[model samples]
Target: MPSMRTRPSRIVLIALLVVAALVLVAVVAVSAPILLHRSAGGSGQEIPASAVPETTARGADGRVRTLSAHDGDGPADLGAVAPGETLRIDGSGFDAGIGIYVAVCAIPASSEEKPGPCLGGIPEGAESGTVDESRLTSAWVTNDWAWRSFATHQYSDASEGSFSVTLTMPEPASTGLDCRETRCAIATRADHTAGSDRVQDMLLPAVYE
Candidate 1:
């Protein structure tokens, strides 16, 4: 009993509803994994696992420069890994008799500029500025000379010889980082020992387990 004018209006309304539903589904599909990504702890909680938790960009030289593992030891020290793979740290010369900080920092494969910390869970718009690290549950800490300057949780009794730090690399989808970004494993002595901070930083390239 509807006239031609009403018929057209109803059709438009139905079409609009379909479009809205599609858009919602698309958004959810993209965000589901990120929303579910796991962290060593919950918000505002200190996640010290004894555990837990990009890709590539080049320099201007027309040559692609990649930073693999940088442990003073050798390449074999920092082996390659894949998404969701568990990385084993053979704490050979790291530290002993003291606590240490262990973490994994990653860059997404889609980043263009120099890759930096994996800063997930940071406040929106914080990346452009210094988002309080305490607020960022996913920032990667570098195990350089001053590495300790940035750690929150300290795992005691890190490997000096046979002890090891084991961590599972976060899956790209869960990390909300681009698939190609590089990931680095950093372990620094919690307290100064042997007159040195004794830092261990290694870059991990993708090579699936």
Candidate 2:
């Protein structure tokens, strides 16, 4: 017959072993997803540089400007901008201080429906970058379910937040893909906050390049 004290020791040892096993399992469970995600091309990819069509934006005063791309230097190019479509933006030299919403619409000049403005709900994974005025880069993406990759590196700045310029979407994207009427926007607030505005600019998928 084993003493009760001896049995207690055995029980404790078994508990410890169980806990150790669980710890190992937990480590594997957590790390496995991250490892697999990265291997699956999580986000970073070798995007080649190509000739992107740029829409030269002229302000009401006739000042010439270039609409930024959502992802810069991606394989896809920015071609023509159409009406009622949203131009996603990415750039440096712009304020990203956005609080709650950022959504808008830009209708084509040939359409009868007036372009309506809307608020963009905050993006799912919101992050922040530098506020230096020297840096100039970032990209814009569509909120459509297709996960369509739109303009890349269309706007940016080192200051982290500054919306000095606005861009409009063109009719025909450089990719020649028929674009939809709606577009999404992401901008840096004057104080480096995040915000979205109604802009015009079109982006094509990198795969098409």
Candidate 3:
């Protein structure tokens, strides 16, 4: 019973509404994963500065990075850790813009040496169960666009450059490093994106039993 001219206007209004709804749906689809990822992990408590055996390193850029660990409900002694136990490592004062890898590695023989041949290699995803070996290592590189888009577990605070990851201590033999003969450590370094950069390199020495 409407005039022809009014019918066209009504159709146009309905079409606009439909377009708006589609746009909203698209936005949510893109944002939901990111939101969920950022919320997935527990934000661990800050390690006290006075904690014994805490390790600190200063990058060339002068950022003082600190690494510490917690075992079960107690603070872990960085100098001693049992193999195959879960340890929560907390790091701060890193350059969030630079990606980093945290793993158990051989303590480099010299300050100029890069830590590596680490346990668990590199993890493929941020979410648990997504990567079979993520239990032994973690990567935090929200600065990398591809990682940000695909990784479902946000392990680091992009703004503060701090991260908390729980790593299951691997057997010394599995790390390709002789922990009993050579020193081993929970170490961090620039991730593959900036593979040659060592400014983020730091280590918390640990001996496995």
Q: Tell me, what's the RMSD of every candidate? A: 19.0, 16.0, 9.7
All candidates: TM-score: 0.29, 0.25, 0.65
lDDT of 1 by residue, 1-209 (tens): 77889988999999999999999988775455345533221111111222222112222222221222332344333334454444444333322333333334452233222223442232333335443533323332223222334433222233322234444445444344443443533322222222122122223433223
Please identify which of the two predictions, 2 or 3, would achieve the higher TM-score against the true structure.
3
Candidate that would win on TM-score: 3
Candidate 3 residue pairs that clash: none
The 10-residue segment of model 1 with minimum total lDDT is: 40-49
Candidate with better lDDT, 2 vs 3: 3
- Candidate 3 residue lDDT tens string, 179-203: 7787777777766555656677777
Flag the better candidate by lDDT, 1 or 3: 3
Q: Write the per-residue lDDT of candidate 2 for residues 80-199, one digit (tens) a residue.
A: 333433344433222222111222232223222222232222222233322222221222322221121222221233233222322333332323232243432222211111111222
Decide which is better by TM-score, 1 or 3.
3
Per-residue lDDT of 82 in model 2: 34
* Candidate 1 error regions (>4 Å): 1-80, 106-162, 173-179, 182-209
